[model samples]
Target: MFFDKSHLVALGGNMPSAKGESVETLRAALDRIASSGCELLAVSRFYRTPCFPPGAGPDYVNAAARIACDAAPEAVLNLLHRVEAEFGRERVKRWGQRTLDLDLIGAGDAVLPDAATYQAWHDLAPDAQQSEAPDRLILPHPRMHERAFVLVPLADVAPEWRHPVLGRTVVEMRDALPDDALSEVVAL
Candidate 1:
């Protein structure tokens, strides 16, 4: 089916789910997403990266997927959350290790809430970022450009996708990071 826009979802997991291995869980999630109405366009090779807090948990397997869908951004995000739940993901701690993590990175050129609100969260202090979560969806993922785990795999599937607010392509954003920033994301 033809879709009105292209969407991006970032996937990661450090723990095995009820489905078994982390990789298998991710593959199953992809199938679930495809069956939930989004057309699977492209999938990036999984990369292994250390847990965010340095030693929080086991290293995570991360990847990105490009999807085509006509659903509203909120609806698509809801679908992603549902898939995560199916994989036994829990939100006990902010940025905690998980069995499955699916994030709605962006959809077409749409920006949620507004540019200013998105920017505020995007530029939030590291301490504040860890303790707070937005009340609404933010488009193009405010911090997408700042994470190697997100960018490296995203480059594999959507290198040319530009952030609607920042006007930077995925490649550009990935390139702007410090040289050692992406050293940990080794392709599997």
Candidate 2:
């Protein structure tokens, strides 16, 4: 079955880009998304978030945007990567700082790479998770539920978008997080 649904994308960055500051880079990314054929729907307020690994680099500025488009999940992901490259993003380090990070958090209720594939990566041990990267895109982002940086901003733009596998709303996922989980994500 084919579906045309709005995709949710998470935007983040810590390193300055050709656009200047990280926050400006994120804003430029949103513009890129719109220009890539997706209708820019909503953008969450920018937040100051500490680096995921703590001290990997400068604190990142994060936000989320909802976009309506007919592109398939992989195509949308490819577009995101292209935008990242346009802004000077590099893959030198895992979870390392970058000029931009555009994560395709979810696409309506469509799950890419199948359920089993998503679960395998989703269930990976934490240590292994950091060291490994999937060969293909994982829909609904395998780890979207576990990170406050992703969820907090997601709640702003798509609180009601349900996860295809977890069946939980973005707000529910964010609310389920421990207070300490979101301690470092403060509004900018």
What's the lDDT for all of these models? 0.91, 0.90
Tens digit per residue, CA lDDT, model 2, 5-31? 688989999999999999889988898
lDDT of 1 by residue, 1-188 (tens): 22246899999999999888789999999999999998999999999998998889999999999998778888889999999998899999999999999999988888887788988999999999889999888987988989999999999999999888889999999999988988988999
Q: Against the hidden true structure, what lDDT does model 2 obtain?
A: 0.90
Q: What's the lDDT for candidate 1?
A: 0.91
The most accurate candidate by TM-score is 2
Tell me the spans in candidate 1 whose CA falls farther than 4 Å from its real position: 1-4
Count residue pairs with overlapping backbones in model 1: 0
